[model samples]
Target: MEDITIHEFDFALINEFFTELERQGPGSPEETIRALGFIGNLSNKTKIADLGCGTGFQTMVLAQNTEAAITALDLCAGSIDKLNATAGKLGLQNRVKGIVGSMDNLPFQNEEFDLIWSEGAIASIGFEKGLNHWKRFLKKDGYIAVTYESWYTDERPAEIEKWWLDAVPEIGTIAHNISIMQKAGYIPVAAFTLPESCWIDNYFVPQKARQEEFLKQHAGNKTVEDMIAFMRHEADLYSKYKQYYGYVFYIGKKM
Candidate 1:
């Protein structure tokens, strides 16, 4: 979701892997609307910021539903270019614009946005830090909707748990995240776990296909081989041990 530094060869392979997909993360437009439904009263006056908006898939969904101005920010210029082109084609050029930037150093002014949305990207700067850093950019009483990879249960396979611990920080149950939200100075409006279809259907299933294509194209490249192995490891792990952890969406309003 967020940026990860990788070898140049793996980087090329990965950029190719995701280039053709509408969504880079495991989310559907329907799920995005479901989260937006929790926030009431929308109008042209509303302004939104979508952090780490890979290719701006969800950004377009938001623009289509609301008359709000949205800035889709991402670290990848190629992603921003695709987002811009899509926004233009959808005739949402005035409402949606893609910015190439980092989430940690948001370029917008303090209290400028009415809503801040992030999907599977908060971990780039750590969840707690992301919340604290982004709050300044949101207006008073504005909402922030985000999804985080979380531990669903306390008891789990030690090996998988260790793998996740190394991959992401602040792995916790729903209640644990709710506590974190309160500590970050937001009042929860709604919370729910994303359905598994979000992963299997939207993400891994397509990712698997992409991997297959890469194997044929980059046949003997060690970089592609290592990259493919790592990517496959995630899907394989989830296939065997999905119940232990998953992404959960939390909607909160700034206090």
Candidate 2:
């Protein structure tokens, strides 16, 4: 058995996840952008860098909603390829430039962007590393908007606890996320709790359904077994941790 991080699992299943997003409806990405403080500030003066911008859904939305030029990046070449293809089709190729790279080490000049945006990707390298590593890319007074899971209470369900221990092993709860950001010289601007329904409707239930359908269609395939394993793991996590686990959208400015 190969040891894989949650980020790797997510990258491998990006296509299915995007399908789930589409099925879940529009507000998913829209709410994410709004939470990131991009809703009202999309203007020509802003230059945005979207790290781990898988498939460019938010990249396209940012380009359309805001006049800012966006440099969308991801570690996965497949994701960048998909994002570029989609951008070309949408005629947004000019506004959004796709880059293939790692988030741990960004390929940009210091203080290059007015805003750094990450949705569901900061945890790939851990929140503290993300805060410290990405800070140099933001100009003085620039902001970063990130979303990560936050703990609602001290009580954690066993399955959820087990998954994190097995997978990430080192991530802190939401309170730790806030402390990490502040300690890294970012002033907390805005924070919001993501509704639990978003996870159930957008990730858990849809992923379960998709895995089931795939298994039905491709019975006895070895690949189906892997897919089923991933889905079952996710379902177990959500079932046990739904109450204590939630996402927090944090907006912080360089101090």
Candidate number of the best TM-score? 1
RMSD in angstroms, candidate 2? 3.5
List RMSD in Å for every model shown: 2.9, 3.5
In every candidate, how many clashes are there? Answer: 0, 0
Task: Tell me the TM-score of model 1.
Answer: 0.93
Each model's TM-score, in the order given? 0.93, 0.83
Q: Write the per-residue lDDT of candidate 1 for residues 37-156, one digit (tens) a residue.
A: 998668999999999998888999999999999999998888899999999999999989999999999999999999999998897688888988999998889999999988888789
What digit string (tens of lDDT, one per residue) describes model 2 on residues 152-175? 676676756666656556556767
lDDT of every model, 2 decimals: 0.86, 0.73
